[model samples]
Target chain A: MTARIGVVTFPGSLDDRDTQRAIRLAGAEPVALWHKDKDLHQVDAVVLPGGFSYGDYLRAGAISRFSPVMETVIEQAKAGLPVLGICNGFQILTEAHLLPGGMLGNDHLHFICRDQKLRVENADTAWTVDYASGQEIHIPLKNMDGRYVADEYTLDKLEAEGRVVFRYLDFNPNGSLRDIAGITNEAGNVVGLMPHPEHATEPLIGTGRTDGLPFFTSILKKLVNA
Target chain B: MARVVVDVMLKPEILDPQGQAVQRALPRLGFDGISDVRQGKRFELEVEGPVDEAALARIHDLAESFLANTVIEDFTVKIEEVAEAVK
Candidate 1:
């Protein structure tokens, strides 16, 4: 049976369709989830796509963290539901308190959009089981508030727990702490990253490199085997 | 009336390429004397009423928990009787 995954669409969300396409390309059913809809549509996992939700008012992801669907996402994530937050979605995860730390403005105080290089730090998460730890991959990263920050205690905890999933391999674009490109919760189900993996899943549209397909495929395999 | 100021930033462990890029541009902008510039944002909030000490504490909670990222950014809170400052 093909696995079903849900991609949420929030107002101002720009990457929902791309995420859906990635899910479909990975041989999984892509279900469209609305921000106001509380049900997850019986999907195996959820991807909160990147965007400027709620026009990024008050702070990035601050207002949208209270959306109806996030309440359910938060509860289910705590119970070990697999969730991936990309870029602004990562912002929402932090805002919802599902993940540690927060995202701030780029250190240069300007919008940054580019193809970013990253190294896979931990490959054991629900969404990253397909990649080898320490592997290098390049993906597109575009956002204004993309800096990742946390307290020293929290950083130590994340590092000590092996929850730091991705790190900047060649260059640091947004000045994230410890060069952390992404991280997972203690349960290993919730993964949040600042890069746009969904944008790198297709061969023709991108550099013909599917460097990010593993994220979708890994979760589908987890569901198939579960 | 009282106000709170929160400044959040990224940690020093990571390289701030953007900040460095801007620092490099400062000399070319005819501001050759200026150097070493770093950038971040500031948020100032006005409290609703006679905010008790507990309410002020709540604001700090908001700062550390969600308002400010403690890892990359260091935040300082200043709770001054703005009514006196204004007068």
Candidate 2:
């Protein structure tokens, strides 16, 4: 059976379609999920794509964290369901308490858009298995509230547990603590990052490189193999 | 009806670039001597009945769980008196 990957579309989601396309490109069936729907459709994995969800009101991903779909995602994720949150999705993950820390406005207070370089620090996660540890790749990073913050203790704990999955390479785009571009939960089933891997999935598109395609393929391979 | 207020602000240790930008502009605007500036959000909620201790406590919980992200922000909840309107 083909791996069915669900992509959630919140009210203001901008990248849900692109994420679906990326999943299709990776040979997985893409299931469309609504923010208000509590059902997950039994998808093998879920990808929370980037966008200004709920128009970024009450904070980037704050209000959307209470959406009905998230209620199920949160519960299932804890039970070892594979989930990937990108950009605003990352904000939602943090707000939902599925991930530690929070995202704040960029240190320079600007909405930055750029092709950013990142190093895959952990390749064992559900969404990163296709990449080798320490591999450098470029993904499109764009956001106003992308600066990641957490208490020193939490930061130390994440580092000690090797939960920091991705790190900025050469340049720190949004001043994330320790140049952390992405991280995973202890189980490695949940991952969140500020870059838009969906945007970089096609070689003819955004960055003209397919570095981000690995994210989709990695999850698909894991699900199919499972 | 009663009015309740919740104020949310970033923790002191985190960087406040928006506040800093305003502070930087102050000196050029002839408003000097201000050492620092921090930005925050204020939310006013109108309740249907008396905001008793129990209600206040509920609002506090709301502020902690929804109104504020405790990871990066601190919040305070309080009752606000409604001002009488002048005819």
Candidate 3:
């Protein structure tokens, strides 16, 4: 049986379709989940795609975190459900407190769009199992509020616990502290990152590299094996 | 009717690039001697009925949980008295 991965579409979501396509490319069934719907339809995993939900009002992901769907997403995610949040999705995760810290405006105070290099620092997470630790890959990064910040204590704890899953390589885009590009929860079932892996899943498109396809395949393999 | 105000500001330790940009432009505009500038948001809510201690406490909770992200910001709540119209 094929694994079913759900992609949530909140108001103003721009990448839900692209994320669904990426899931399909990874050999998993893509389920479209709405923000108002409380049911997850028993999907094996969930992906919060990038986009300005609720017009980015009251903060990038603030209002969306209180949405009805997130009520369920948060509860299920805590129970060990695998969840991946990309870009704005990452913002939502942090706002929901499923992940720590918060995203602020880029230090440069500008929207940046580029093919960014990243190193996989931890590969044991539910969303990153297919990648080898220390592997370097390029994925597209774009956002205005992409700078990641947290208290010194939380930063130290995340580092000590191996929760920092990905780091910027060569150049640190958006000025995330310690060059953190991604992180996972303690259980490793929840992961959030600023880069758009869905955009890099096809070799013929975008940067002509399929480096981000593994994120989808990784979760699919994990769910099927379970 | 009563008016309640909530002021949200980023923590002093966090960087405020937008505020800095405004500060940088001030010297060029002949507005000098300003040592620093910090940007923040102000929200005014209109509520019906008296804003007793219980209502004020509720607003405090709202400011803490939804009006501002405590991780990066601080907020204060104030009650603004509405002046009666001239007869």
Q: How much of the true A–B contact set does each candidate keep?
A: 0.44, 0.94, 0.81
Is 1 or 2 the stronger prediction by lDDT?
A: 2
| Model 1 misplacement above 4 A | B1-87
Alpha carbon lDDT of residue A76, candidate 2? 98
Per TM-score, the best of the predicted structures is 2
Tens-digit lDDT string for candidate 3 (A1-226) = 8999999999989999999999999999999999999999999899999999998899999999999999999999999999999999999999999999999999888899999999999999999999999899999999988999998999999999999999989987787999998999999999999999999999898668999999999999999999
- Top-scoring candidate (DockQ): 2
Q: What is the TM-score of chain A alone in each candidate?
A: 0.98, 0.99, 0.99
Decreasing TM-score order of the candidates = 2, 3, 1
DockQ value of candidate 3: 0.87
Q: For model 3 chain A, where is the 10-residue window of minimal lDDT?
A: A201-210
From the highest DockQ down, the ranking of the candidates is: 2, 3, 1
lDDT of 3 by residue, B22-86 (tens): 99999999999998999999999998889999999999999998999999999999999878878
Q: Estimate the Cα RMSD of every predicted model relative to the unseen true structure.
A: 4.2, 0.8, 1.1
lDDT at A137 for candidate 2?
A: 96
Q: Which residue pairs come into collision in candidate 2?
A: none
Over B40-63, each residue of candidate 2 has an lDDT whose tens digit, in order, gives: 999999999999999999999999
